[model samples]
Target: MTQSLAKRVEQIAPFQVMAVMARAKQLQAQGEDVIHLEVGEPDFVAPKAVNDAGQAAIANAQTGYTAATGLPELRQAISDFYQTRYQVDVAPERIIVTPGASGALILLSSLMADVGSEVLMPDPCYPCNRNFLTQVGAQARMLDCSANPDFAIDLDTLAQQWQAHTTGLWLASPANPTGSVLSKEYVAKAWQIVQQQGGHLLVDEIYQGLVFEGEDFTALSVSEDIFVVNSFSKYFAMTGWRLGWIVVPEWAVEGATKLAQNLFISAPSIAQYAALKAFDQDVLAECEARRQTLASRRATLIAGIERLGLPVAASPQGAFYIYVDVSSLTDDAMQWSLDLLEQEFVALTPGADFGQRDAHKYVRFAYTCDDARIEEALQRIERFIAA
Candidate 1:
C-alpha cells in the first residue's frame, strides 16, 4: 500500500520564519558567528515574579491539565487586564485560554470558516495566518497594502476586495514584520464593512503592549463582533510558556468553548497559573520596562538602517521589526539574505516570504537583540553594503 498525505496537509506551505531560523542555526553550527535577527522572540528573560509563580505551581503539583476554558483565576485576570488596560469590558467567561496565540488562531479559523470559505488579510502578514487558513480548507486572499500607506489596510481597497464568499477578516494591530498599528477609527470603519458583508473580524493583539508611538487600539472597542486575540509571548516575555487567551463576542462563546474542549483540552496548567500573577502591579511595571527597552532598540535600529541607505518601507510604531525596501541592493531577497548570512554573518528574513508584491526586493530585520549586539550588526551590515 502507498501512503499519502491529506490534500489539505499537502497544500499547506512551510512557515518561512522556521526555515530561516533553521538555516541560521545550521550555518552557526559550522563555526560561523551568525548575528540572528530573523526570529521574533525577546532576548530578555521572563519576569522574576512570573518565574517564581511557575516554580511555585510546580512545587505545589499544579502540573495537571486545566479546564478546557482555563482556570477561573487566569480568566478573571485576563478579563481585568482588558478592562484596566484598554478600558474595554470583557467578562471572564468570554475568554478562552489556549496553547499560544497560534492555537487561538487555529481554533478561530475552524469555528469561523469551512471548506470554500474565504479569509481576507493584508499582504506581508504573518505567514502562519495563511497556513492556518489552508489547514482548515479555507481560501486565503491577500489584500494589497502599499508602502506609501505604511502597509496599513485601506477601507476602499478592502471594499473592492470583499467577495460574497468571504466569511471573515484577520487583522493584526501593531502588525508583525511591519509594526503598523491600526487606528481605532480605521478599525471601526473596517468593522462596519465586515458587518455589512455578514463576516467576522479577528484581531491579533499579541503585540498590544509593545506600542511606542500613539495609544494602542483594541478591536473590542470598535465592535462586539470582533474577536480579540492576545498572548503573553511578546509583551510579557513569556514565549516558552505558550499561554494565550482570546476575547470572543457573547454569541461566539458557546461554539468557541465546545471547539476548545475538543481540540485543546486546555491550556498548560502551570503556565496559566503563572500568567495569573502577570497582572500584579510590580509585574506589570516590569513588563513596561521591557517595552521601553524595545522602544530604544527600535529607535536605534531604524536610524542605523536609514543611515545605511536602505529605505524603511514603514517605521514600526509598535512591534520590534523594521521592514525595509532593498530593491536598490538586489531584487532577490532570499539570495540577498543568504549572502548576508554567508558574507556578513547577519541573519534576516527575505520579503518574498511575507507576500507576492515585490517582497523579493525587501527584507525584515528584528531588533530584539541587545544594544551592543544591535550595534555590532549595524556595523557589519554597513560594511557589507559599502563593499
Candidate 2:
C-alpha cells in the first residue's frame, strides 16, 4: 500500500479521442446512430493480398520472433519501395520493422531522449508523439504552427524556436489534425539545420501514401541522416496488424537494434510477413486507388464544413483530417465535441488533445470513414448547429 506509481506516470495525458470514441460506442450500444469522424484509423480492410498473406502465415505457423531489427525480406521490400516510389535508395540494413509506429517512436525516444532532452514539434501534431517523448522524461516543446499557412513551419520559425535543450525535432508529413505536408526544400533545410545544431530530426511518415495535394515527398529522399517512422496502419489499412517501420541513419542502426531488442523483441510475426505483401505491385495499386478515394472524401468534408461556417484553418494537403477553427461556434472545443456527440450523435475530436496553443478554438474531423458516414456526420453537425 505504501508503494505508489511512478511520478512520471502522472505526466502522461489521456488520449481524448479514445474517450470521445467511447461515448460514441456507448451511443451505438444503445441503438442510437452515431456517425464517427474522430478516430484516425482508416475504415477499409487490408488489401486481399495482404490479408491472404497474413492468413497464409498463420496457416504455415510462421509465428516466431524475428531479428530484433526486422524480417530481412520485409526490410528489403521497404528499401526497394523507396527506390521505386521516391527514387531513394535506403539500405535494408537501416530499416527496422516495429510493432507499430508507436513502437518505432518508443525505440527512438528511449535511445535519443533523456531527462533534459527537448523535442521540438509542431503544435497540433499527433499527440502520442509527445507522450512517447514524455515517457522518457523528455520535454515536448510544441511550436505554434496553427497560424501558419498549411500549418507549415518556415526556416525562420524553426530557427527561432531551436532551444538549448532541444535534442530532437519531430515532424509529420501530412501532419495530424492539420493534415499538412512539409516541402522537400523544407526537409532538406531542416535536416541541415538539425545536423549543424547537433540534434536529430524525426519525420512521422505514417500518412505518407495518403497525400492528396502538393508534392508526395519523403524525408528519406533528402538524406539518410533523418529518422523516419512509418506504418502500415494508414495507407495499407493495417491498424489491427500492429505493424510499422523506422528508417534510422546507418550509423545509428546498431544502437537502434539494441533498443528494439530491449523494448520489443520483434514486430508481430504475422504482421511482418503480411507487410511483405503490402509492397506488392497489386497492393501498391490498391493503396493508390484508396488515396484517390480519400482525396474525394476530403473535398466532400471540406465543402460540408464550409457550408457550416466553421472553416478549416487551411484545406489539408494530405492525411484525412481537417482542423476546423471552432472559435466562431464555440471557444471550448472539448465541450462542443461532447455536446455534438450527445445531442446529434456526431463523434469528432477536440483540439485540446493536440496542444495548448489556441487548442480550445479548434476541432479535428477525420474523413477515414466512408462518404456515406461522412455525409451523415455532416448532416448531424448541421442539425446540431441549427438547433
Candidate 3:
C-alpha cells in the first residue's frame, strides 16, 4: 500500500515564479544573458555596520541559539525604532523575533487560526500568505480587490466578505506584486471594523521603509492592538540573515512566546546581535540612499512602460514592483512571460503566482536591478511588442 501524504500538503500551491526563475538560471548556465525582473529581492548587500557586527559576533563565537522571543537588546532597539520612525510607542515585551517575516507569519497563523477557520485577504496578494494559513489547516478567503483603488482591501470589501468563521484579516502595506500601500485612513477604518466584528487585524509591514511618495505609516500608528509584521530583509538589506519580528498586543505575548519556543526554539543568535547595528545612524543613512535609488528606478520603469502604452492597473507608491496590465499585449500572461523569457531573454513574474482574479491579464515587473538594466529591458520589450 502507498503511504498517504497529509491533506494540507496537497493544499499548498507551488510558487509559480520559481519555475520561470529556474528556467532563467538554466539558460544563464548555458551562456544566455537574462534580465531578471521576476524576483522581489533587492540587489544591495547588508549595511557595512550590520555586516561588521555579524563578523564581530562570529569572531566572539556568539552563535548559540537565542531565546525563542529573541535578544532583549534587539527587541528594545525595535521598540526605539518604532518610537523614532513611526512615533508609535511599542513595548519591547510585545515583540517576538523569528527566522524571517515568513516565520512570524507561521507563528501568528498558529496562534490565531484553527482548523476550518477562514483568514480574509485580498486577491492578487503575496501567494505564500494563503499557504501560510493552509499550513495550519485554516482557509484563506481572498476577496476580489481589483475594484478598490491601489488594489488594496477597503472597509466595504471587508464587511461584505468577512464571515462568522473568519478569524482575522491579513494585510500588506507596500504589498508584493502590486507595490501599493493601503492608506492610513483605510487602515484605521478597517481596524475599527475588525474590532467591531471581534476579529483580529494583521498587517504585513515588511516593506514599510520603502515608500517613495507618502508618509510611511506603520499599522501600529493606527492602533496598539493591531498585529504588525516587519522584517530586516527589505529596507535593511539583510535578506539572507533571516530575521524579522512581530508586534502583538501585550495579551498575546506569552502565547506567542510559547509558540515561538516550540516552533523555532529561537532566531539566530548571531543575526540578533547583528541586527542591533541596524539602528545606527550611519547604517540607516546608507539604507536611505539605497531607497532613493530604488525610487528613481521606479520612476524610470513606470514612465518607460507607460510610454510603451502598457497599462499599470495601480501605480505603485512604494516597494520595488509594478503590476502591469498585459491585456493589450496578450490574454495569457503566463505564456507571454515564457515567450518573453525565451525570445528576448527577459524574465518577469506572471500573474498566476499572485491569484486567479483576472490574473491572466496582469504581469509584475521588479525594479530590483539597476536603472541601466531596466532601461535595456524596456527597450527589448518595446522591440518585442513591435515584432
* Clash count of each predicted structure: 0, 0, 0
Compose the digit string of candidate 2's lDDT tens values, residues 1-387.
Answer: 598989878999887778788999999999998887888877889999999999999999999999999899999999998998999999999999999998999999987888878999877788888888888888898887766787666667577777888898888897888888888998999988888888999999999988888899789889888999999999999999999999999899999999999889999999988899998889999999999999888889998998998778865999889899989888798999999999999988999988888989989998988888888888888999889
Global lDDT scores for all candidate models: 0.87, 0.88, 0.91
- Work out how many backbone clashes candidate 3 has: 0
RMSD of 1: 1.2
Worst 10 residues of 1 by lDDT: 11-20
Model 3 clash pairs are: none
lDDT of 1 at 175: 87
Q: Which stretches of candidate 2 lie over 4 Å from their true place?
A: none
Return the clash pairs for model 2, or none.
none
TM-scores for all candidates?
A: 0.97, 0.97, 0.98
lDDT of 2 at 169: 88
Off by over 4 Å in 3: none
Candidate 1 vs 2: which has more lDDT = 2
How many angstroms is residue 183 displaced in model 1 relative to the true structure, after the best TM-score fit? 0.6
